[model samples]
Target: MPRIPRTKSKTGLYHVMIRGNEKKNIFRDSEDKDRFLEILYYKRQNGEFTLLAFCLMDNHVHLAIGEGTNDIAKVMKKITVSYVYYFNKKYKRVGHLFQDRFKSQVIESDSYLLSLIRYIHYNPIKSGLVNTVGEYRWSSYNSYITEKSNFPNLIDKQIIFMMLSNDPQKAKQLFIDYMSKETQENFMDLTAEENVIDEKAARLLYMNMLEEKKYKFIDPIPLNILQEVVSQLQAVTGLSIRQIAFITGINKNKVSRILRKHSKLQGD
Candidate 1:
């Protein structure tokens, strides 16, 4: 079957994910990780996108970017192909290193944009790579805090700080609050986002709640409870839109919308 076209971002910004091909480790050690970042930095300088945030993992990477002189596809292709070439040459390996295509979710609204930033930065903590946000040296989190950025051309921190407040210091402090572990607990748990779905169990949970509420597709849904249900259902399983619609009688569009709204799933 032909691939469905990706949803375009009006804001030209996205939360992008690039995983290792076949669930393999992309970064075998600190040296590999460093090399990947170096290539990423060079590509960032090429002006396809503005880097906002990033997290390098054992088998994947998360990048927050705003479209610049080039589109997302070109930006990612340039980055991924180069890295793969380097990886292959160094390891004495050939063929795909990263996945066939990088995955992305548009970062449109300011609220979702901020949430996505926290989500990306929180990746290391979620993966047990580090105990604190500061401990993770590979992420762009520190570039936002320090006066002189470690990655001068690699990250765009001004936009985020501007979103936080008019005052620079106050904005930094707000970002500090937002990135802090204590603050993350107020909304979503980092690990909870990593929940793997059990399909049999998930179908039961959805049915039980629907039956209890006697919810019908035509009936007005309580947005709060509906969001909660969608989140729980997603956490427990990786059900497709059609599968979810089949169970809830809510239709594919509604299921897709709900999942998109609470899109804080597992990290890259």
Candidate 2:
């Protein structure tokens, strides 16, 4: 079947996402991330687009951008190609670095635009990379909150800030308040919604495992059972090590050790 065309953004604004091939880490180190950002900044010199927000996770990236002199496709192509070349050269690898076609959703309203920005800013938190949005260094959230960001002019915050309030300080405060709220609001994303298991489900999995094994006591679980429990929690529930530890009352380090050992055993 032929490919479907991307939905055209009437307002020339979109929420764009791209990930590494097979869900691998795109930026191996800080230098790699810096280079990618450098390319992103360099591409904008032509005035082809306006970047509003961005978050660089290990394996993927989220961008809120508005088309100016060129379409979003052309803008993304320039940015991705430049970075991929640098990435492949540095790693002494070849072939595609990015996955299939980049995903995007049209942002035609101010409400949706603000929500998308919030979601993009919150990506690191959602992925358990950082506990707070302010703690993450690779996002545009700091740009909105601070006047002295590393790349202050890379993103255009005027429109979003104005929407929050006429007063700059008040707008910043409001933006912070809005971000602080716990959100169940969903938006377009590459990861399937079902893939992320919540705390309740994770705990249920642990409880059910103990009951199945006819084990009454939670503490001092047999060594073999502990390994199986940790490995199964990861394999079956897809919960992170921290989450698994929380659910099973296991030390996070022990959980990591179990998974690593299990993986090594499987490899052998």
Candidate 3:
């Protein structure tokens, strides 16, 4: 099938995601992640784009960018190409490192932009890599809240802060409050399924349900609760058993059995 053309953003602001090929780890170590950031900073200095926010994960990356001298596509090409060359050379590997084209959603409103930033910052926590956004070192969260920025030139925080308040201190406080609040915000991601829910959305639903029941999602949930979760996930997401298991950390065979029992009960 021919690929659909990306919708041009009138505001020139976008939330972009790039994943590693075959769901492989893009950054094998700290050096790779740092090098990717270095490339990003270089691009920023060159007037490529306004980097509002960024989160680097093991197999993927999320970026909130505003257009500069070039369009989003051109900017992504420059960044990804540069990094691919560096990565392949350093790792002694070849071929495409990134999976197909980078995925992106247009950011036209300030509210959605803030939500996107929070979502990006919370990626590490959502993936169980950390307990909180601040605990993660690979994202731009610190740049927004810290009194002194380690990479001052990397993130364009003034635009975001100004949106929050005229006073810098007040804006920082507001940002903290906004991020601290637990939300059910969802956005475009790499693992989206056509006509069905994405992985992130599914995970958010599970977490919300668990939270409402006063059950910590990170803890071992009861078998009955797992069954309910699996059934709901299957019905709402239309995702496979493996996908459900991956999302909930349940065994594939158990997820299937849970679904079977639910189906039998519904039929009766």
Candidate 4:
């Protein structure tokens, strides 16, 4: 069966997960994790995307990202591709460093958004990698609580803090309390799903909620027609319009117009 197409977000806020190939280890040591973070920082500086929150586990990684000048897919590709290259070189072994495709879930609701932040922060604890979230040095949990500037672009602390408390300091403290042992809440739990269909349905439902505001395709074209154009373009070029525009420095609107025109010409 063909896979369902990925639904893109205009504003680019996505909860992304990249796991090791075949459930293998992505990080051999602290150096590997640090290298990944460094690549993330470099991508942010290049204005590819903004990292809202992130957690680096031994076998997988989680990130909440807001699209910046580039789409999330491209941004992630650059980060992962570069890291894989370095990883292969350092270890003198290679095939695929990460799973074929990273998993992404759009965050649609304020409640789910908050839950995601908590979920990501609590990953290490849930995995038994650490007894407390704060004990995990690779995650953004402490940075979110302390207002530290180490990861300027990795997390949008303002949003989380604002949600937690009206006062930033109070919010930080509240977030800390939530992650503390006293809370007894398990945020990292995954939902039960019988199969891929069930999981995809759940993901779509979650993504739709995250995108509550109606966004017409970046082009003013009708929805069905626009999708057809996107399909044709992807089939021929193996590139998303967003990715093409980012690489070529063309306006996304122009790319959409070109694709629409090309589609019309073909039909004629």
- lDDT assessment of candidate 4: 0.66
lDDT by residue (tens digit), candidate 3, 1-268:
9987786777899889999999999999999999999999999999989999999999999999999999999999999999999999998998999999988877765655777788899899888999988889899998888856555568999999898789999988888877875544556666663212235567667677777667754345788887777788789878888667645655567788999999999999
Please provide, for model 1 over 1-268, each residue's C-alpha lDDT reduced to its tens digit, 9 standing for 90 to 100: 7875776888898778888878789989888888888887877787767898888888888888889999999888888888888888889998888766777766655655665677777778877788888788888888889856555557888898898789999988888876773323111122222212223355567756655777632234687778778767766776777656544445467677878778754332
Model-by-model lDDT, in order?
0.72, 0.78, 0.82, 0.66
- Candidate 4 per-residue lDDT, tens place, 179-228, comes to 55222222222331111221223333323432443422111344454445
C-alpha displacement of 56 in model 2, angstroms? Answer: 0.3
Which residue pairs does candidate 1 place in steric collision? 197-236, 197-237
Q: What is candidate 1's local distance difference test score?
A: 0.72
What residue pairs clash in candidate 4, if any at all? 51-154, 108-209, 108-210
Number of the predicted model whose lDDT against the real structure is largest: 3
Ranking according to lDDT, highest score first:
3, 2, 1, 4
Worst window of 10 by summed lDDT in candidate 3:
191-200
RMSD (CA, Å), each prediction: 11.4, 13.6, 8.5, 15.4
Location of the lowest summed lDDT over 10 successive residues in candidate 2: 192-201
Q: Which model is ahead, 1 or 3, in terms of TM-score? A: 3
Worst 10 residues of 4 by lDDT: 192-201
